[model samples]
Target: MPEPAGAEDWMPRRLAARRAVITGAGAGIGRAIARRFAAEGARVLVADIDSGEAESVARELGPPALAHAVDVSREESVAAMIGRAVDEWQGLDVLVNNAGIGIAANTPDTGIEDWRRVLDVCLTGTFFGMKHAIPLLRAGGGGAIINMSSVAAIVGVADRAAYCAAKGGILALTRAAAVDHAGEGIRVNCIAPGTVDTPWIERITRGYDDPAAARAAMEARQPHGRLVSPEEIAAMAAYLASDEAASVIGAAMVVDGGMTAR
Candidate 1:
């Protein structure tokens, strides 16, 4: 008879045994992913523009987590972040491209600078992260990449022309990467979330004339009558990173509380 699998032989076990680098991990969905991956036994490199917050999260995750201050929009910064991960972890296996910004201005009123800034962080940042990450992933023999897109990529929202364009660009980028690297044992996918109740969303609502009303309207817009949680998005990221999701490539998973159902 065939021998039974050892305690550690199970697939998808010890997810944290691999090494991962996540951008924007100082807060929101990125922070949640960092926590989850650390819990799963993966050594995590938490990279964010906010150095203090990144260090705090890394400390909270204890020994296996490393923190770095990274501006993903810049090629050199992104290259350094990826290089640090390889140096610290010996190699990199997973990458979560979660750094992004939101801009709330109509196309006509959106200043050239604002549009450029939003695109630089949201779209160009993702591109740079992917560019730097692929070599490491290839060196490691293969890996999974999760790009954080948004429901905005699928549907129109007012006063967010730049944000929408950047997210839409991410979806296309995700698809292209998946195809380009499939032969190299790399899997690429995107997650498009709805109105998630992160600090960013809170800030957006707080600026409204009726903050409470605006918050309620945001909730009401979701078919679930609530905003998506950072943890929920992190859960999806974990699944995608696991071997169980080996065939889930070039796909855009929507975690939007059925917002796109209509």
Candidate 2:
């Protein structure tokens, strides 16, 4: 039988009517996630430390998508970001704590300042985001929280002591939060991606004498022989945020292309 005129399409809109906030959404993985969520019918708040970048992404997504400047490491900033989302959307349904930074240094070589900076943004920032958003999620009757961890948390990465520590903390936090809030209808989960081919990777590569060789070497380390794409991670995030993943709390969905299989 033919479909009626103006009827809904057969496509999947897994996140229809969801109000979501994605931090560090101006570029890379966060940007991809924001785009995916919007395409899936969710209204997104594109939050990032770079106001211009955030606004650009929000503009690209058109109406119902907003941009906010936020330093997720600061509790006050994180609070304001969440408050704005609730105010604009009348409630919150999804929060993606995707903001993070790293320092390239071994434990002994890593300075206290570098260590604190990485932890403050990568780990504590996630804490701040969840801390403020959870209350609103409860008020709205339930929601999903997706924390962006990394393969470094599960496998050792040379010259990334602070990053590894921060990501490891996120996994632990996700598990505890999931357990504590599952009864309240809230689901918490995480994504541990391997080296993603983002601008961040380009920057790291440029620091090497042979940028091409360095990038190739990095890709060779992956079992798939290529860095993961931000869009791949975004797809996983969309699943975790949608009703399809209602039973996926506390899970660390690895998008590492079998990086840990060996």
Candidate 3:
């Protein structure tokens, strides 16, 4: 039997029934990804240290989107968060470790405590996310893990010693996990984004002596002369989680708008 004329063979949403857990989903890029995932019909668990903000984002997403508080640096919290997602959706399909912090200082100027804090939240936190999410993802069959790396991971930037270390570590873990889990039906990857137009960047620019000049300097870093949008990153997340990227594993997909072209 032939199909009806003009019948498009596709779904209205890309991620239907896909269970996803996105950390730092309260605001900035995390919030955008959560929103985008929910829009694509994924059952999302919005996890953040900020409980109120997490709830708000989940509420806005409607049913099947739940909110939870999680300190990603803590293994217990990460475990509980992942457990919640599994409990709600019956399993896990995608895990996006998007929570991170930055410390703006050179190696000589960065304090021990500052470096520890940055690594604890950015590097260790990602470790926790992957450690807990991988088992469930494997049990439910092959799934995707998207770590949020940065241009700092692949390039040297002034006044970003701690951030560079943590993000660079993420790149290492992403690749290692991809290798270790490829046989387990799990795919691990990462996104290395350039200067993005998020609240975090806005706060940095506003704190500078000349906001306009500071923002212009950031814009100049990327050849596109514009910051990447959170939604654009979300789109990448969608693709990585969907079957469309079945063969994309251990890839640090650069979403830097040619910032590292030089």
Q: Considering summed lDDT, which 10 consecutive residues are worst modelled in model 3? A: 2-11
Compared with the true structure, what per-residue lDDT tens digits does model 2 show for residues 44-95? 9999999999999999888778999999999999999999997898899999
Query: Any runs in candidate 3 off by more than 4 Å, and if so which?
Result: 1-12
TM-scores, one per candidate: 0.94, 0.96, 0.94
lDDT of 1 by residue, 1-262 (tens): 2221111233244474788999999999999988878776778899999999999999988877889999998999999999898788788899999999987899999999999999999999999989988987887789999999999999998889999999999999999999999889999999999999899998999999999999999999899999999988988998998887899999999999999888
| C-alpha RMSD of candidate 3 | 4.5
Candidate 3 per-residue C-alpha lDDT over 1-262 given as tens digits, one digit per residue, 9 for 90 to 100? 3322112345236777799999999998899888877777788899999999999998887777899999998999999999898788788999999999998999999999999999999999999999998988889888999999999999998999999999999999999999999999899999999988898999999999999999999898889888899988887888888888889999999998899987
All candidates' lDDT scores? 0.89, 0.92, 0.89
Report model 2's TM-score to 2 decimal places: 0.96
